[model samples]
Target: MVEDTQQPQAQNGAQPQVKMQILAQFIRDLSFENAVATKGAPQGEVQPEITVQVSLDARKRGADHQYEVMTKFRVTSSNKSDNTTLFLAELDYGGVFHIEGVPEDQLHPFLMIECPRILFPFVRRIISDLTRDGGFPPFNMDPVDFVALYRQELQRRAQSQQTEAAPAADQRLS
Candidate 1:
């Protein structure tokens, strides 16, 4: 005689200790452009009329997180009398990260810092690859300080909020 001791009877119960893990990750966008012809006024000279803007953002989607950190090169070289746009290139590099079982306190940092850090190398490689593919030297972006960047963004938002609230306070006084 054999005694069966196994029992399975749980319905609508707490999740069965799901082992949260990254299943898939990948890039979402990438771009590159060469604008020296517009920048140097037909001359083979590299102009200094360019502005580079880098931005980063992250959001949770489904059981994963997504990040978009873009670097834009806006070239405005003056040829004669007009501020002509010699080259305008915007490279938006992004990634989707599968995250699970992350603690609440660590979730924000995981998305804002760790996720971007992981994606940055790939983004840099793509930029260099694209620049070479676009018939130019490899474009290597400088290493980013995400912690500093995050602090700056928070400060800027706080300042903007203060400015917005100042007017309302003034109106109340009048």
Candidate 2:
């Protein structure tokens, strides 16, 4: 018996077939600090407030069709009333993917959005475990909004470029 390797064509047009495979995934770096342990546990009725920050990066490797995508996560929990930090966890997770048939112009967003979407569950689990082991309740991180995150970063870069270009223009006039 032979496997059906051919993919169905789309209704719109002759779009190239898309193929993506996650070759490897890993925790490139991890750290968790329990501030409560260092400073001594709080007195009574500790209310914890948590904040999470996420960033993404992707780069093409030497091998054809292979790219590396990294997701960085930083989590901090603090006492809501006093702003005292309870715990902090930072993780850098990476995945190597073999992607084919995506047009070059669209590759960056694909890596940033889709690849990290695939890696998010594992990243969440690590944080949950990190918090639990660090003597707090298991911290189930909310799912990251990759599309919004990507858009914000793009906006930030555009704003930064405009600022830099304005400075250069002023220098030329002087």
Candidate 3:
């Protein structure tokens, strides 16, 4: 026999309680290179074309109900015409989160998608400051679509699993 240990809050027709908190946020790593200063100013006014690449990672911490999520950004600027380098900025930022009430199976997406979504503004601000201080206009990053990114990652993982399984199945048939 099993006992039903339902909370009063949920018995009233409300959803289960979910708790999330950002325990800490910090810059894990940062690097910026100003080509205009090092390589000398390029001839003529510069048309800077900036490209920003982003990635995310997450893992459980030693403490229970705590996880660490990291967001990495690689920003590159180049002249659209002659393609000379302007500057490059790379930043790795991390956030420590204290979360509860989410089920184990859903935690992975909660960490990868929701946690980073919560941390993105800080990451964007840092990048903007880094670029502005490096002598360029403030680089405000566009909003990232975490849901789409999560979906793409899931699809990629599924494809990789299928690819791996196909070879093993072939070997088994031999």
Candidate 4:
């Protein structure tokens, strides 16, 4: 007899059980440029300072429990001395997820954190391959801290809203 390892449903009726499933994953957009590396110069001569930026967005997909999560990456490699750009790579990767039974309060974080975690490895492989095939050493990206990123973005938005509302509050005091 096989022992069942499934988690039992919550005894409390108020908490809705959550289920997350990846429906599809795809490269929504990809662009890679190699300026100096393609010229056949020695690898040491093309030392580049690389910078990467990441962003995430999620939206409803017109069906119940369906959502689309998009992760965007902007990577730039530039020469250290003259600041000439060596390469610029941008990728927009997206996944369709089926999120069911989660509370409204927990939905945002689930989409931002869990969905991206599922899709990151594929995105990482793509970046590595693109850079290697572009005639330079493969660029392996470090793992992203999605939770921290999400928190920082939330704090930024809160601060911006407070800044924008300050004048209105001051007017009411006058």
Candidate 5:
């Protein structure tokens, strides 16, 4: 007579599974202003320029094996004078993802590419909405290719290391 507890459960293994879900997303901070609006758009015939800066971070959530990915963006648009902040915005967005029984080889790509890909649309919407509310036409970011972006970033870092090494080599030669 075999004990009921001795019976194997669900394929005799821990069961391969992967689940990625967004826990929450919100604007940690947002600021927008049109200083030139009161000045009637100002004169001097200067073309408008917008600068965008983006940053991303990821961390593990303790023993649960869960992960959190946070992405932030800062965009500022102004005339040549730089005194007017035509459109300025700062957004902090993140998501909580659960991954289990996934192979190590696939984990890197899942976090770098898939996770950010999922969170990007929400972040983009926030930027668009903020621009519209600031009295300017909606400023929508172009769709990002996380796979390509990640590859490019890796390449950039590699090149930067090579450049840094070159300087050290030059010092040795001198």
Candidate 6:
């Protein structure tokens, strides 16, 4: 007699599993600009301050389990003393993903953090390459803390909801 072997389900009768796959990655948009320093400006007088902004967005594809995540980066360099622009770079990189087994309640955080983490290295490389090719030193972006970013976004949303609900509550009380 052959005994059947199968994975046991959780106590709640649901399978506990999570799976994510990247189908493809591509650059949705890329732009680079190099601005000349003011004439007679001390050459390399001071290192320019670089500011980088990052954002993540995700949407469901036509397929049930398929989704697309976009990671965008905007970088700017400027001399604080004179407020002169040095260089600017913007990139919108995207990845197509297939996710399964994640509960609906947890899907948002998973997509925002995990999907972007997978796409960041490629986006970083593109930015570095663009800067170097644009006759400037390669600007490598520091690794982002997606968890922190997600938490901040959650807080922002909570605050906005509270603010919106407060006015409605006030109206009902009046």
What do the candidate models score in CA lDDT, each in turn? Answer: 0.56, 0.92, 0.92, 0.88, 0.76, 0.89
Clashes of 3: 0
**Per-residue lDDT for 29-146 in model 3, tens only?**
9999999999998898779898988889999999999999999999999998789999999999999999988878898999989998999999899999999999999999899999
What is the per-residue lDDT of model 6 for residues 67-152, given as tens digits with 9 covering 90 to 100?
Answer: 99999899998887777788889999999999998989999999999999989889889999999998789998999999999999
Distance from true location, Cα of 88 in model 6, Å: 1.0
Residue 161 in model 4: shift from native, Å?
0.6
Candidate 5 stretches with Cα past 4 Å from truth are 1-17, 37-40, 44-51, 79-85, 166-174
Stretches of candidate 2 exceeding 4 Å from the true structure: 1-13
Tens digits of lDDT, candidate 5, 45-126 = 7566778787777788874768887777888877766556566778888888887766778887678788888889888888
Best-to-worst order by lDDT is 2, 3, 6, 4, 5, 1
- RMSD vs true structure, all candidates: 7.4, 3.1, 4.1, 3.9, 5.0, 2.7
Candidate 3 structure lDDT: 0.92
Quote the positional error of residue 7 for candidate 3 in Å: 2.1
Task: Provide the lDDT at 52 for model 1.
Answer: 52
Work out candidate 4's RMSD over C-alphas: 3.9
What does candidate 2 score in Cα RMSD to the true structure? Answer: 3.1
Model 5 alpha-carbon miss at residue 24, Å: 2.6
Which of candidates 1 and 5 reaches a greater lDDT?
5
Against the correct fold, how does model 5 do in TM-score?
0.72
lDDT of 4 at 78: 88
- On a 0 to 100 scale, what is the lDDT of residue 25 in model 1? 48
Quantify how close model 6 is to the true structure by its C-alpha RMSD in Å. 2.7
Query: What's the distance in Å from true for residue 110, model 2?
Result: 0.3
Candidate 2: global Cα-lDDT?
A: 0.92
Question: Against the true structure, whose lDDT is highest?
Answer: 2
